[model samples]
Target: MAGFDIGEKWPFALAAILMGATFFIHLVAGGRQAVRPLLADSGTVPLDARMTLYYAWHVVSIWLAFATLIFFLAAFRPEFEAIAWANGVMAAAFGILAVVVTVLKRLPAAMLPQWVLFLPVAGLAIWGAIR
Candidate 1:
């Protein structure tokens, strides 16, 4: 029960909450707005490409859920701290990639605001890992 001290591990808990929320938002809103529309474009998009993108979207959903679980466990289990660190690094990478791609495409920040959702999760998880 060494790391079961919830009061001292609030950052990991908060990161878990944020990541869970992001997962749900991605599952519900992103599915409705982006996934469905992309799939619906059968006339313009090729079958192989559409299916590939759909598969990738599901992969993200799975990763988010897995990260949420890992961070949540890290809040109570000290051994999972390393996994949390890895997740934080990946989250930071995702955030940076989103920003770079948005800028490269000359799109408005609002159009690709994934960094907003990702960076805080990275920060919190990393903070928890060090503390």
Candidate 2:
């Protein structure tokens, strides 16, 4: 926090914080409301503790890793432009693909809102990387 001036990079920092919060919210609340029910009714062994653990672990790990990485990039924006660009491109592509998939699948209304959350993250990352 010493070398990083929050005022100078508030947009990226705000974006990072929003992204982190969104990831956390999705991992917990959204997962419960959406993923848990799907997983439960998938005809898989609902009582399989190991399967549940494995699934939770996979989801949490990816969510935390990506969110943490974005925070790191926000904290060190100038030094991490290449990393930012790489992540930005990936995030942007994923967002676009998710939108397309959602439309093609005619996913639930809730899904669109969830996917829309990533656009700001992608925008901020690309903005920070280029600037």
Candidate 3:
């Protein structure tokens, strides 16, 4: 944490930006993708809004948690590196889980990019936290 607050520590800032971007893209785009099909035939049939809502909540909750870790890393406000490490581990775990869930849910191919993008974000966050 010696250079945590300095501009010289670009990695932490980059990791935060990447992770935040990942969360933003996934939250907005993924939500649209999940909800589209449900709303497609809403006029003709009883759309299962529950499924779309479920995905939205799940993605938001997970990515937001991960985003918090990235933000913490960027801000470098933690008094203890251990706390950052803990959040980093959680972020990485959820990053992996996001990929798995994306495939398991059989979502559109477009949604896969965000999960794939998250891998690097997760790696950077962990690296920043530990380094």
Q: What do the candidate models score in CA lDDT, each in turn? A: 0.92, 0.65, 0.61
Number of the top candidate by lDDT? 1
* Residue 74 in candidate 3, Cα distance off native in Å: 4.5
The lDDT of model 3 is: 0.61
lDDT string, candidate 2, 3-73, tens digits: 55655656566567767776677678866875666666655545576477657856754864675466557
lDDT at position 66, candidate 2: 76
Cα lDDT, model 3, residue 108 = 72
Clashing pairs in 2: none
* TM-score, structure 2 vs. true: 0.68
How many angstroms is residue 78 displaced in model 2 relative to the true structure, after the best TM-score fit?
Answer: 2.8
At residue 36, give the lDDT of candidate 3.
58
Reference-based lDDT, residue 89, model 1 = 91
For model 1 the local lDDT of residue 74 reads 89
* TM-score to native of every candidate shown: 0.95, 0.68, 0.59
Q: How many residue pairs clash in each candidate?
A: 0, 0, 0
Worst 10-residue lDDT window for candidate 1 reads 2-11
Give candidate 3 regions above 4 Å deviation.
1-4, 39-74, 80-83, 98-111
Q: How many clashing pairs does model 1 include?
A: 0
Q: Candidate 2, overall lDDT?
A: 0.65
By lDDT, the better pick of 2 and 3 is 2
